[model samples]
Target: MSVAHLIGKAGKPYTVEVEKCHIRQFAQAIGDTNPLYSDEEFAKKTVHGGIIAPPTFPIAMSEESDEDLDLGLEYSRMLHGEQRFIYTRPIRPGDVLTCQLKVTDVYEREGKNGTMEFIVMDTEMTDAAGAHVVTSRTNIIYRSVSANA
Candidate 1:
């Protein structure tokens, strides 16, 4: 069966409160030594007014779940193709955000080996006031069984 029917399928939305520690840890893990993500005093001196998360901090804030939408993909044949994030404003500690993922597109393409299926989705994040914050688009590539042979 094709995954075309899941184009608009969305998962359960979950809330997460951005925290100082998590942001700081994520920065450190990614080898980012920017003071804006660690030093509150330094961050206070900057335009952001306080410590702010790094551009990729939302990845740490999001949770993976199969609550509602399931692609029914073969785990062994799946490969992460691409990921891009769009942000309206910088994320700071104490900000509460709700995130939900929905399938946007599903298509098949002829690869060098054989046919590959691409699943595209977007994870949208919104603040407590229902303002859009960030949108993370992810693409997953699945190798068809015939391609393996």
Candidate 2:
């Protein structure tokens, strides 16, 4: 299969509601002991004024990709290759967020065994006021049986 042919030309946007419980749960799951993510008093002393989420907390707030979209890749064959987030501002509790994600690139390369498909997604996260909060890039590598020994 040609990866270039599988690229999703357009992207669908999704929204997520940020709540204190969600943030707390996510922080606990990652074993993050940061006071900003848990201690309300400690967080209130910070510039954020009240409890603030951890830098990586947005990942937990994101919704899954739309299943109705023709993403063109088998979920079982996909492997998370890498992920990065650039933050413009801190995320505080009760802040509703929206994310717009699009397939930035898709390509296939010959590997030692055969071929591997690479997919890149670019996501822009904004607050309710439409202020850009963060940008995240996710990469996935799909390796078929022919692409691995």
Candidate 3:
């Protein structure tokens, strides 16, 4: 099945709620020991005035923020090609974040095995106050079934 052609030109947007516990777990999973992320008291002294999440904490909310594409891509053949995040301001606990996402680009490259599909997704995260908190660019490379054989 040609799953690539099924994905429409425009992608869907999604929203997610950010919580303090989520931030703490993400910090722990990433082995980040920063006081700003781990200690509420220490964070209170900083400019943010509260517990602040690490730069990559936004990823933890991806599952909630991602659209249900159901593209039929084989999970075993999928690979994380690239990821980048640009932050306008630090993310603090208790901030309700909403993400707007769209497929910026989609293309295929022919290889000896078959064709490799590249999907690029652009995501913008904003706080409840409408402040842009972060912009994330994610690239996913889907290897053809033939390539995995």
Candidate 4:
């Protein structure tokens, strides 16, 4: 989306039921050996009282619907620049989480090869009870590459 139109746009929400299996897979993929992420019984005894996803678990949440921003940039040109997450509560299994994504910032810079466009998006996540759970900000950079190159 164009920065002029996207800035201050309310986040469009995407909801999903956090599954135990998904959490296990994500933890395993990240090489996290924390018992709370994989062992249900172990997690049950912890303070959380149940299996909870990792702090970076939001990365596993797929887009709920096609609300993709039409940035007029090629997919091949995109690169993940940075990510940060702030959590108010741990994500436990069976929690129906809703994350709303909104364009936060857009800017341009000159990279080693060419001009690069940066798009920053923030995802605000909440539990089914509407309690704030996590806020994640991701920056994606798009490199301008000529067709000849």
Give one digit per residue, the lDDT tens place, for model 1 in 1-149: 57677788888898888889989889989999999999999999999999999987777755544364666777788788998989998888998989998899999998888778888989898999999999988898878887666
Report how far off residue 71 is in candidate 4 (Å): 4.0
- Candidate 1 to truth, TM: 0.90
Off by over 4 Å in 2: 6-8, 64-68
Top lDDT prediction, candidate number: 1
True-vs-predicted CA distance for residue 36, candidate 3, Å: 1.2
Provide C-alpha RMSD values for all models, in order.
1.8, 2.4, 2.9, 2.9
What C-alpha lDDT do the candidate models reach, one value each? 0.85, 0.78, 0.77, 0.78
TM-score of each candidate structure, all chains considered together: 0.90, 0.84, 0.78, 0.80
- lDDT of model 2 at residue 139? 85
- lDDT: worst 10-residue window of model 2: 61-70
- Which portions of model 1 show Cα errors greater than 4 Å? 64-68
Model 2 RMSD in Å is: 2.4
Tens-digit lDDT track of model 4 for 89-124:
888888898887877888888777766778787888
Task: State which candidate, 3 or 4, has the greater TM-score.
Answer: 4
Number of backbone clashes in candidate 1: 0
TM-score of 2: 0.84
Q: What's model 4's lDDT at 46?
A: 91
Error of 1 at 79 (Å): 0.9
